[model samples]
Target: MSDHTPSPDQAPGAPHPRETVQLIGQDAAQQAFLTAYNSDRLHHGWLLTGPRGVGKATLAWRIAQFLLATPPSDDTGLFGAPPPPGTLDIDLDHPITHRIHAGAEPGLAAITRSVNDQGRLRNEIVVDDIRKLGRFFGLSSADGGRRVVIVDSADEMNVSAANALLKMLEEPPARTTLLLISHQPSRLLPTIRSRCRTLRLAPLDPDDMQAALAQTNTEVFGQTDHLAALAAGSVGNAVRLINLGGLELYAELIAILGTLPRLDRQRALKLAETAAQRGAAEKFDLLLSLIDIALSRLALTGATGAAPMPEAALNEAETLTRLSGSPRQARHWAEVAALITARTRHGQAVNLDPASLVLDTVFKIQEIAGHSR
Candidate 1:
């Protein structure tokens, strides 16, 4: 595989998880792992489970670094054993750290979706990908040092590949630690889930999100709350939003909704044309997602008597209140959202013109709004 092939594990325009030296807003998960290590009861297999972009991969990298760098229960005899590790942080300039950054760490292996014979990255981790570890285990074992293997997402492993991994978990090699990062543990085999101890990570709060973003040099000036609300505390999602001007797009969407019942044709046309522009496919997909978000918020506002807080876009609450002021209206919008989403997605699948598809979606929402009024 070419070294420059974009990794499936890393988000676009975001630093690779291994490049993130520190994992922020996950102290509880870190503590749990530390508790396992300090007690000398560290499991051979670890499953780090959490939402996407919540630092599961980063935590795995952290654990790998800690295991390889820290000497195992040093036995000095007369000097007595050293104290247990209280944190996962190691010196950033340590040789092990340096090697890991360079992807030259002999004791570490990171497995993601691998390129096939055609040089195309496969969507699933094939059995061959898992089998390659057999070779890795063979070579790394000669050193007799701790070895770490990180599977970015065990969920993406095919059945055969998973079975291969299952065998390793069944009889793990000496001084080897397997870290599995799973965004959705339910998709994994029950047997696989049962074999490993789970360390669960949670979403970051706004402050933590800001700090995490800053660590990557992603500075958001006055829109932290808005971005936090929109991203749901996922740094990966936050970066995508920032890279694609999602905030401005979402705000424009809300403004269009504000003109509902008597929808502004000119404004709607402008938005649709923007989505149709060349190289705007990602933006178009995000626009559809924002529409779904608006509809869901409308439904939620009517049901709960309030809009979801921190407002993902300007004037969103006002538009939601005006358009879905009652449960009946909210239900109407929900049904409209479902039908329109399915139809538009199908149109997109069939290569429908982007401008018309987006415009059609807006008109349908306008029809629903007119009825509600």
Candidate 2:
């Protein structure tokens, strides 16, 4: 059998977003950028803001490729009718495409978290990484072409790094474009955000999500619907869920919940044991996450009085209705969710036994169900 394992860093062995040539599920953002570029009102800096894994980085790279490959128009001659770029695409054989993919493009620089001397990735993008942008900009572009710098995620930058970037945005170089990808733009410096035009990318619809997964050769087979619902429209999250066997685990969790108030001790113990096994840290984390998701859905279903959709697991809707059928029960579950979330975080922080943590959370849910009865 072929190994279907994703790399530790990426999903389905797909190339880095920078090396990805296609952009999916972000047509409006792309059009807004093309409109600006075609109107000759392109800003020096662009802040690409959106949820994680929704094509922000891909759009940044696409824009970088377009800017570096397309030269500025000169209205100097009578026949100077240079076609405006309608799309952010250049041929794969384009020199800029080859150079950017190889990370050898002098006109482009990408700033991201760097490895420390100990060979581990640092937690944040430091000022020194931003300083590299200074050196990159200091050198004139070969042939005086446009320069582009991409910060894969501005949210990961340290305060010092952000301030350093702010200085550059304050006095941007001629013909330079800075693309900042931020999952949470609210966390960035207000001054930095103010200097850039914002392009917000929305989460993908189901069709787009499927297209994205297929493009990466992610083999979901029969679980596409469950994966889509569990991922909440984020392709990156879907990939992680698929790699972790989240669908089956969530189904198991819902089945256990279905026996709530009565408490299925044997099945619950099996799940807790599985999560507590050595080297199952990822599974443990995913269990806690899925529990939180299920609880949230229950609370929402109760409070809204809307028909529940069994998106994540079979019989989820009926189970939620049975467990949290009234506003009071919904409030009770919400409080339980908050308490369990805090406890779970604390348990992980203190390195508590994973089995005990899982059992504790499940018992709490059972207790709440009992009280509701």
TM-scores, all models, native as reference: 0.91, 0.91
User: Which ten residues in a row are the worst by lDDT in model 1?
Assistant: 74-83
Residues 256-321 of candidate 1 have per-residue lDDT tens digits of 989878889999999999889998998898888888888888888887778889888887888788
lDDT of each: 0.89, 0.85
- The prediction achieving the highest lDDT against the true structure is 1
TM-score computed on alpha carbons, candidate 2: 0.91
lDDT of 2 at 176: 94
List, residue by residue over 15-36, the lDDT tens digit for candidate 2. 6786776788899999999999
Can you tell me which runs of candidate 1 are displaced by over 4 Å?
1-4, 74-78, 332-353, 371-373
Name the lDDT of candidate 1.
0.89
Error of 2 at 251 (Å): 1.0
